[model samples]
Target: MGTKSAFNWVTLWASLLFVVILGFSRLSYGMFLPGIQRVLGGSYGQLGILGTVNFIGYLVGTLCLSPLISRFTDRKQVINRMTCLLLGLTLIGSALSDDFTQLGLWRFIIGLLSAIATVLVLSIAMDAVRPAERGVASGLIWLGGSAGILVTGLFAPFTIDPLHLQGWRYAWVTMGVFGVIAAIGFDFATRKRGVVTIPSQTESKLRDRESENVYRLLLNPKRFLFLITSYFFFGAGYIVYFTFLIPYLVSKGTPSLYTGLIWSGIGFAGLFNGWIGGKAIDRWPSGYTLALGLTLGTIGVFGITTNNLLFTVLGASLIGLVSFITPPLMTTALLRRDIPDHLYAVCLSIATAFFASGQIIGPIIGGIVVERHGLQFGVASSAIFMAIAALLAGLYGLQQRKLEVRDLPISS
Candidate 1:
């Protein structure tokens, strides 16, 4: 097979693993939220803060470990070991939590581990694939994310009954246990020989040098400035949609069981969106594809704000579709830009940390908005954030065009 074709297969497998692991780790939060609230009996304000705590942990983990992996040229083994370790910790945390305070602490750690595992997989895929394939590669990776959401939603309703047992705890433990088992199985399966791809010695050494250089280059204060700014807003805007869409739907009079199903639809659509988004990125400019998705999100959020049930459901699906399109497009854009491969993990990790920071702040902001104005306005507010992101993204595309012109030697 050609190099691009081979990489496509590799990205697909890696992404599948990531989506399964990430879906279980991240989306399960919603499944357990209600059960936990019953025991804690806090206002929406308090629960929102607790959600922020989990995201804080996620942000920290992504920021700390994304760069840490740069120190190790071959981190596949480390990734394996850490994945299992984190999963085991998750199970232990779930089984032992005595109250909300303790549960929040454990949840935080779980969020960190979840970020590490997902980012690691993405980093490896980016490192291994050709640039031309990145969009598709990213799309494949996000398919696993969609699957993760499906798993959590499917299991949460059947697995948890707050009044009967610690259904919330049970749900968490099950996901953790399964993750551990999957990790062990993956470790054993890959133990035989040289499965990981490494560059030639000269290229490898060059890559290592470039990794350190990227830190200095990023300090240029102008090169990636627009992309960086756009990323932060993207984080804040995208997360509000991800974290609250289902809950908002439920409040609007969608039945609880249907809420779970809607969550499932989000995941299901994301599975296709990742693949479609990635392919679109490959066929066209990353900016156009990304802007398209963000625009869809803006329109969807605006529709939700109107509070019509049919519009709400349609809007939710559009948001989900648009949301899934983002990761692959944005991540591929980052990878293809001026950044180097060796430091890709760290840079993306740091970006994710900022993304996490947005997550950390988004819910608290949402809570305050909900309290002061109302949930509809709170939900509608995501459109403002997404609109800003889309606008900035458009500017970045123009900036890139200008750079292309500048590099043309003033000839044309």
Candidate 2:
């Protein structure tokens, strides 16, 4: 293949893998939650606990990833493929589950598998691109989740009643089959590819110096703290919005079909995230891009709190446009830019661990708020957390600006 063709081919398979791992395994739960609850007969609080369990598993997976990769460096591809396959099997297991405990077990396993697959796949994909293009590539990879959300939104809600209360089960089965296919294709596509290496001695020395600087920055908590904190808050905030969105809409007397459509709209709007948000990341500072996305997300979440259908639709669309994937894409791009290629996966795994920790808390708190105050208050709480995330990202941006200014060469 030509160089351009090779890039496209690699990106395509990687994004497909993301569709299965991040999209189907991770994000699809929120869309299917109401249907699952109907069949399993659980309170919102109980379902929220399931979400927490899944995130906890994700946290464990992220924590374990660095060591596992070091131990099996030569077998990264095998690990990635196996993780994806296991995630697919777990989704299928979820479909067969008859009780809440069974479903939660599958979810936890899914989370663990998905976390490992996500970091590995993203590392592999980013390796294919030059540093300048990593931002766009990351956005495109994340866009696969938007596609998953669209697919789930289209069928999950409607499936509940049409298949004699087995719609959710069928949905899980379908997602599992698709995930398996994607994993097989991903394995084939990436089999011959490897991480790109720098060839110039001069460039290698420069990279080493830059890597040392980045390591120092990381060691200084003042310089690196805000970025991880922003990630944590963003994770906590967005999961709540997605987890309860469908149920909240239904509670407000909206029809299931309409709710599905609204969810689909969010996904459709997200289609532009790779292009729009990626361009923003490419042109602006990473922290600024992250802060902008979070600010818009905060507004979008607050819009949903109004509980007005039109406003909610607009809110959901806004969220789809920037919030869902933008923060992580920016975070990854920033880290990829500063961290050495060899250290990329380990640093990203650490960052994702922080993100996962927030996710573990988000659903539990959101459920309690919903149970006590109402869904509106629960969603409003998400907006508040997102607002805090925006603030932290903005501070990070300002800090980056100061560093850039300090590093500039003096002229005679």
Candidate 3:
């Protein structure tokens, strides 16, 4: 196939993979947590541990990403990921023993594979698109994940009941069936038939330099420290909201159905927000866009603390719109710096590690705050971190201006 056809199909598949890996595997866990806990006869502490284990797995997956992608063809890597996803889902669905250890093992595997698969699909989509359009392309790709969450939020009430073991099992089964279809689609997209296939050595070399380039770019450019700092704060703050929003609402006397609806609203809003974010990055300085987006997102986080239904809904909408904004903007900014494609993966991997670190810590901190001070205080606290991110981004914008001035040739 030609480049046009190849890019279109690849983007489609990448979006679908995002839905499967991130939405179904990662986000769905929170939705299903109560059911899993009941079925396994575990406490909230175990549930907390489960979340930690998952993030730890995500961290390790990013660590192994270079080797995993380097060692396999794109087709082989995707297939392997699908296999792992199916196995993880199957184990999760079939469990009747109530063993926390068994559940943890499955959750860890799913987390690891999900991270690897997510990064792989996104990189695949990027490879298909031109460098200049990568921001919009990534935004479109991340919309798939939001779509998955939207669907789950709208339909999951019917599929998952905390009181019923069958509900949890059925949910996993449904996701597994979807995975089967996605795996089929991935294979078709990478098939050897009509299209252009870049050879293994080229891709192999790209994967090889991913790790080395991340550090090199970090030290050499110097501007990225601000970007990295903003990303770290975003990770720490946004996840606190994602992990705690529903519970906070429930604690505030909102029904589960309403909370689910609100979460779905966030996802629906993300569909357009991702587009707007992508376009903004395409036109504006990324540092400016990053600060503005974080400011908007920070307001949403504060809404969570408002304890009013309307305000919370508004907050969810704002947060949804900008939640994944940073990744695409960050990618576009890095690409503009003349960073090579191979190094791109490593750069993302390192950023992902910081993001994962925040994920690991966010829930723990949010939990403690909620337990001691109230859910409102807990949710409100996350906004402070996001605010810090906005400050860093603003600084980055100013620093870029000075750098630009410095790079201009002096008149002889």
Give stretches of model 3 more than 4 Å off. Answer: 1-7, 41-45, 70-97, 159-165, 192-213, 219-221, 324-337, 404-412
lDDT of each: 0.64, 0.80, 0.65
Cα RMSD, each candidate: 3.8, 4.0, 4.2
Work out candidate 3's RMSD over C-alphas. 4.2
Candidate 3, residue 311: Cα displacement in angstroms equals 0.6
Ranking by lDDT: 2, 3, 1
Q: Which wins on lDDT, candidate 1 or candidate 2?
A: 2
Candidate with the greatest lDDT versus the true structure:
2
Task: Name every residue pair that clashes in candidate 3.
Answer: 1-194, 1-195
Candidate 1 residue pairs in backbone clash? 19-144, 19-145, 23-148, 66-346
Where in model 1 is the C-alpha error above 4 Å? 1-13, 88-92, 159-165, 185-209, 219-222, 336-338, 405-412
User: Candidate 2's residue-wise lDDT over 308-352, tens digit each?
Assistant: 789989998999998887888888887777666766777788889
Residue 243 shift from truth in candidate 3, angstroms: 1.2
Q: Residue 249 deviation, candidate 2, in Å?
A: 0.8
In order of appearance, the predictions have TM-scores of 0.86, 0.91, 0.85
